[model samples]
Target: MLRFAPSPTGDMHIGNLRVAIFNYIVAKQKNERFLLRIEDTDIERNIEGKDKEIMEILKKFNIKWDELLYQSQNINFHQNFAYKLLQEKKAFACFCTPQELEIEREKAKKEKRAYRYSGKCEEITIEEASKRAEPFVIRIKKPKSSIKFEDILKGKMSFDPNEVDSFVILRADGRPTYNFACAIDDMLHDITYVIRGEDHLSNTPKQIHIRKALGYTKDIIYCHLPIILNIHGKKMSKREKASSVKWLLEEGFLPEAIANYLILLGNKTPKEIFTLNEAIEWFDLKNLSNSSPKFDIDKLRYINREHLKLLQEEKLAKLLGYEDSQIGELAKIYLEEASTLNELKNKIDKIFNEKRDYKDFEKEANILKENILEVIKNSENFDEFKKELMKKSSLKGKQFFKPLRIMLTNQEHGPELSKIFPILKNKIEEVAKWW
Candidate 1:
């Protein structure tokens, strides 16, 4: 089984969604069960409805999971496992006070050394600790040897025994820490694969230690995807509005387009554009780039336009709040200048709704409007229509075309009239009436 575990802290970033896409697609390709685990154990930081919102976003992207779970549901199990480790002598109670630990940390800083637990509390017998009134935390024993594992994308990796101290499993507040809960849940849920961001690479050995301490000898495959950089050549930050998936969706980006762009990043694909289903046929983990990939908004906009073009003319028009296929075809002409559905809709709306100001050319605009209304009915095309109207007005150059362009498109400049005129030939009367 595979899992896409997200914390309910705030709006999910595109980085989070990209990780989910990788896990979901790989699970389907392997014919394995997929799970959505909402890691909401950090109650202090979790937003109340964000988990439901996350599921909704996943559904919008067509990600289906075989099972769903919240990490808090197994709090009892996580607590019990900590006690189990203590009983097996795989862990010990930590009696260090906050001030004492801080002093040790300062000492390490002064000595220019890494701050690890002094393990002073290990000398206290468990029986002796059972009778103490002071509150204490549970900590797993440090490994005596290196913890090593192979990552599908990163290849062989190793962590020294000293790198992982006797980290706390259960806090003084009777709550399990992140690594303890994550390790316990993965073991209990039978998660065979872990595909996540490289930010969690340091936590892997700690989790592996917890599993090994519990006698879970089965190997869990791992793929730590490289970090994504913004266009400015820095790591993507979730706090930024542009990094958010919610903001991207609200800006009228297609879900398919977003997924296509994400999958195309840092990986080799059969083609530049494809649907989610098409990607499932060819996605392989081995093709992922080890180097970080930059998030190019321009490229995503280009991909969004391609996906918009793939939509049927009638359907595309419906998304733009119109029913006529002609309107849909008309919208396509604006696609040359518009990158998003909202931009396309605004461009189309300009034709029939936006009030154009003629400024210095008001007189010429009115004359052109009257002439076009009179001769447009008989003209078969824009060139034919222009020939008849220009003859009647006896106007030429900027004096003729400028006002005519504003009368037809409600804009001083836009797509060539030759391309827009064909789709909007029937709507010319309505367009002229509004202007």
Candidate 2:
């Protein structure tokens, strides 16, 4: 099984969607079970509605997990495994207080050396340590030799055992740290593949140690995905504008387009537009690049336009802020060149908003302005009126239609003059001939 674990701390950044996309696609390609587990161990940081909101977002993205779990539900289970390590002599309770550890850390800084935890409590007997009423946290005993594991994307990784100290497995408050909880849960869930962002590689050795200490012999694969970076070449921040999944959905981006952009973020697949199923068919760990993918908003807009072109007229009409069934005809004309629904809104806003300038075909626009009232005053057929107006003005080609376009829409280019006429309705007379 493969699992996606998200913390219910705040709004999910757009970057989070890629992790789910990779996991879901991997699960489908491998024909294995996919699961979702919410890591809500830090209750202090948990926000109300975040879990529900995340569920809705996943649903919106069409990511369906075979099994769903809450890490908070397994608190006792994790604590028991920690205690088991203590019983097996694979772990020990550290009685060092915060102040004592802080002093050692400061001393390490002053000595210009790395801070490895002093094994002050490593030799303490379990019975002796258990008898103490003072608060304590469990720490796994790091083996003295080098550790090695094979990453699916990055192969044959070796870690110096000295790089990691005897890190805490459980806090003094009896809650599992992220590494400890993740390891135990993976083992419990029988997860065969662990795919996630590359930043978590530093924590892998610690998790592997916990697994070995707990005697979990099952094989588990690891795949670290490349990250999405900001302009500074660091991980994209959640605070960045328009970075939240919720915000993008609210801004009228189709979920399919977001998925398309995300899959292509680091993979460099030739095809930029694809559905979720297509993405699954193309998902390959080997194709992923080690370099961080730059988040290109313009590329996202291009993807959005591709999706907009495929939308049904009724759906496009709704997205265009028009409920009129006739707007479907309008959608068909403008959406051909529009990149976003907002851009469509701007193009059509002139029908309802105040008019600006009409600079094109000045002489032809002048003729149309002078006689358009006379044409409207006497004729019921637009074809008859436009034919007569053009003949009377002795203009042809763009010189002829250009005036009609500028006089009606105030823009040099748009849908054919015939289509925009319906949008102008009775407001055409409001336009002055003086300009």
Candidate 3:
């Protein structure tokens, strides 16, 4: 099984959406059970209704799951297992108060050394602690040596036990800590692979230690996805103007394009435009680089323009809020330079009809005699009309159509004249006289 575990702490950022896409695609490709698990244990930090907002964001990306669950609902499940470890002597209760721990940390900082837990309560037996009836937290008893684990992506990584102390399994407040809770969930759920951002790389050895301490041997592998960076090469943040998925969709970015761009971010692919199925066929997650990948917004726009080409005229018309097929027709023509649907709207508005405001076409229009308007007003089809204008105006080539095109649409070069009149419905007289 694979799971997309996101903390409902804030708006689902673009990086989170990318993580979900990676996880969802892997699960889909393997035909495995995929699920969403909200790590809401840190409930105090959660924004109001963020859980609901997260769900909506996932749906917007077509990230469907087999089961939906919360870590909060399974609090006792994590709690009970933590106690089991405590009973097995794999973990022990700590009686050190916050002030005492802080003092030790301050002294360590003064000594210019790393702060590992003092293991103050290691000698204190559980029976003695229960007899005292004092409040305390559980800490896993990690050895004072190095811990090693193999990563599918980074390969053969090691961490010092001193680098990671015997971390708290249960907080003094009786809430199971993240590493402890996540380990229990993953083991119980039979998650064979843990595919998540490398931001969680530090947490891996800790979780691995917890599972090993539990005496259950399961070969659970991990694929640490690279961290997504912003344009400034910093971690993506809302303060950095890293857009949310909702905002991208609102800006008229195709969801397919967004998905494709996210997948391409530190992974290899020969082509830009691809369906999710194509993505699965092309992407090999184990071979992905461990380097941090910058979230290139410009690259996303380029890919969106590619997907825009795939859009059917009828569908493209509806997306632009146009009932006329001419808008879609002209949109495809303008979309060669369009990155998003809003840009398409601007381009479509340009040629859906002529520009009455900008009369830069006046100079171009002056070159064509008033007699050309008479021919244009009387002509039926575009071909016959162009012939009449050339014959009467005594002009041919760009000298003829170029000025006529400028007068009609106010653009130097644009949609074909044949397609234009059908779109504009023949206001050549108004166009010529107004200029």
**Estimated TM-score per prediction?**
0.96, 0.85, 0.84
Tens-digit lDDT track of model 1 for 48-139: 99999999999999999899999999999999999999988889999899999999999999999999999998767689889999999999
Q: Each model's C-alpha lDDT? A: 0.91, 0.81, 0.79
lDDT of 2 by residue, 367-394 (tens): 6666776765565556776787777777
lDDT winner = 1
Count of backbone clashes, every candidate in sequence? 0, 0, 0
Residue-level lDDT of model 3, residues 117-202, one tens digit each, is: 98889877778878887799999998556768788889899998876688898988889999988998898888877888888999
**Residue pairs whose backbone atoms clash in candidate 1:** none
Local error of candidate 3 at residue 249 (angstroms): 2.1
Q: Which scores higher on lDDT, 1 or 2?
A: 1
lDDT of 1: 0.91
What are the candidates' C-alpha RMSDs?
1.5, 4.4, 4.1
